[model samples]
Target: MTDTSSAGWGLRGTAGVSFAATLEFDAVEVKLGGRVVLDHFSLTLKPGEIVCLLGESGSGKSTALRVAAGIQPVHGGAVRINGTAVSAPGLNTPPDRRGIGLMFQDFALFPHLTVLQNVLFGLRRLGREAALGQARAALRRVGLGDREEDYPHMLSGGQQQRLALARSVAPRPGVLLLDEPFSSLDARLRETVREETLAVLRETHVTSLIVTHDPEEAMVLGDRVALLRHGRIAQIGTAAEIYRQPIDLSAARFFSPLSEIESVVTNGHAPTPLGLVATPGLADGTAVTIAIRPAGGARMAILGPGTPGRIVGKRDAIGIDICEVSVEGLDLPLGLRQPSDAGLSVGQDVFVTLNREHVLVFARD
Candidate 1:
């Protein structure tokens, strides 16, 4: 999983070295305006490990990060770094002394300061010469060594963001907090910047908590994803674990685009229009929701002497055709696998069949 590049200034030249650091959050909770923002939210990240708080807006993802960084006061609970209690009720430490770096979504570079100045801002307590030297080195690590004199506006969006990261980490913080770092970038540039940012972070061995709503982004960046639900963690695992074995239908859909099909579970199997799918350990007579991913290769069983379904309609998606198929009077929308100039034509009966093993079944609540 390591990438080697000739543009090397990081720990690339070293052998058997990792940026990994240990980070922990213990029963952290926060309240805003008399409402609980985070309740018993907890996660751990090993040194050089990137953990993402994955959830939608107002789900306490950012609040958790801010509290961990000591930027936001906690109403209850505690946060720790490397097992050292950093935040606890009635004991507040200033952000600068917490050894936690925060990179905001807006880059937050001082408008008047040049790129180098912004990076050197945190290092002021150190003598001027030493601070400048460290800032130069940090800028070099982010591939902006020569552009130190350029103002924040002079640099590209990605470069500006990298500057912000450099500023946050200039003091060599033990933990890094990123709040939707790539949300402001255009889609095409976001992934590239993310990759670069991750590389830089890995090089420095900074334990990072990335807050993002995009599941795919979390999958690509995090060693583990904490799916936050209503101020609590709904699921926590690697991308494959969360995607393949979600605890419920909500978690399943949150991690991936899945179509839910209602089925009656019987004898460790669920009966669907596609066929009887075996779901071992599922209680019999329980109504369950079967989650099917788009790339599961489940064929329509309505045609070709297979299962029965009526073609309801089809829509034109930029890269794919989405077909709506009704089975047993239930409308299930699925992305059709075919290429045509006109896309999927409306009203075409088709057979659909999926590997029962890939179907994720969760109790309907």
Candidate 2:
């Protein structure tokens, strides 16, 4: 076993490297099986930044990653790395030829090879001694130095993921692409491994792009998130900006569960059972839908002066109390999430207060 603490395998200085490396997709378009997968997709990743490509399945998230890796050909536009075009009209760079590393959803480690051998596989171009040294350092960097002789099956899922990451970064590629890398792990282990992986990527200072369908995962991992819809960017911004001010209803619902109420703008205000909500910049008599998040706005209390409501149902979730409250003047029961000790019960009278900040008024779709 090597002394992992003293190895300093984390990416240090660029040293001799002069220019910063970047990844760019300029008006990229792709088609597969005669169906358009991506259209006019454009994104840019500055050096050392982690950008998450987030969307539902078939939204072209993985297709964009493949294009960046040079595995998928673009029908139109270009893919560039460090100002050099890798994918364009008739020119295409092979996956291995482009200096980019990729880690698939499945760790893809060979069952027959030892951990050291797997890391060495990426560094085969170096001499025997140099490759051996790099492989050992990479293993130590991932806290798996003692397991160099172990095969893939002998390690836990988290260890295997770290091994895969070590192999990908062993070549010191300027850009790293991860396609749902933590999807295979269980929930608890996924979070731990994700943190570890992010720390390593930051230390390496490699511009990284991750593809995931989970909005929470994107919020946790991305410095900026690019939310795709129908092969196009629906919204792109920091997690705070995306969640606080979604461009539309589709973009808002992507980040959190919402309860919608229909209303018509009257004197620049929409009336709801809770109260009058401001709908500025809207013409009088304009129809609109107001969206509110239970966890963000709702509060429960014993029956009192607040909006009159009767608790029709109650459920105790993992860490919160979910109550279905039927308010006067509302046809549907509004879901409210409060503290577990809320003491709410079915058929009990209660007061529901809506936090004005959580209310979002949008034009009806």
Candidate 3:
């Protein structure tokens, strides 16, 4: 791991700027093959903050990055960097002149160029000595100082990612956009490289927008997460806010697997197989769906007492045991994450206790 504390690759020409460097998307729209991809989408990224655009496939995560990078034309609204409109009606700036850095998922390093040459590729406008200095500092910041002479093929997957990152930040662009840069790495290598990339971003203090489909990756790297669904932003907030207080059932299920139960609101509460859950601001007799996450504040115990449920399925998931319990009168089985020592079997009986704080209630359609 590289030490980011002494890394001096700061933003260029921002010495006396009063306002923070910002990236704003105002009511941006996009269409592909006569199908709407992004509709009236808007976002604002403050200086030195990392925001992750998170969603499943076809949710417009990549389109948002392209629009910000000025490679994709917007059908409506505008894209502003540092309050200057670079993308708007009848006005579009070329990608290379936008003062933005982008790293594609494939790394896109020049196969014929050495690591130092690739890093210096973005610094072409600077003098030879200055570009060399900046490239060396960028490589050192990413812990690839010793591999400057090696070609991309000679480096490991993680090192290649670092090299790509070094190249992107070498010019000290105001905003960095990464489109699923870590998606190609294996699980273990992804974790290591992701951490290194985040460290470099933090030390450099460059505003960034990273696009990813993995919920865990979004939560780990983003200061705030923008959850997209069907060409619109479903929710935007910190990871805890989005996970704990999702706007709807779909948003809640996107972050974690949920067991849903049907109920009707009565006297500000609803009765379930677990217990009565408070339903404030909802009228009586209103149909509601109760969603619970097995790993979210819920406790499971043996059939010694409480609501009895028959275990219908069981599986060992590496460090823990996941069991599905079928309760009487419930249409779907409740999933539980249990300790391995519980000695649970498929035919055994168990009891489930719901943590009201972890339960999410939404009006049933």
TM-score of 2: 0.91
Cα-based RMSD of candidate 3: 3.8
Query: How much is 260 displaced in model 2, in angstroms?
Result: 0.5
Candidate 3 residue runs with Cα over 4 Å from true position: 1-20, 303-305
**How close to the true structure is residue 168 of candidate 1, measured as C-alpha lDDT?**
73
**Residues 105-148, candidate 1, lDDT per residue (tens digit)?**
99888989988888888887899888887788777766678888
Model 3 scores a TM of 0.92
* lDDT of each candidate versus the true structure: 0.76, 0.85, 0.85
Cα lDDT tens digits, model 2, 1-365, are 32222232333321112123699999999999988899999999999889999999999999999999998989999999988999988879998888888999998899999999999998888899988886777787777888999999999888898899989988878899999999999997877678768777876788899999999999999999999988889899998888878889888888877888999999889999888999989999999988887787667788666898898988988888887889888878887887786566898888878787877889985
Model 3, span 152-253: residue lDDT tens: 999988788888998998888889999999999999788767876787787678899999999999999999999999888989999999989999999988
* Model 1 misplacement above 4 A: 1-21, 300-322, 326-329, 336-349
RMSD of each: 3.6, 3.6, 3.8
Model 3, residue pairs in steric clash = none
Per-residue error at 325 for model 2, in Å? 2.1
What residue pairs are clashing in model 2?
A: none
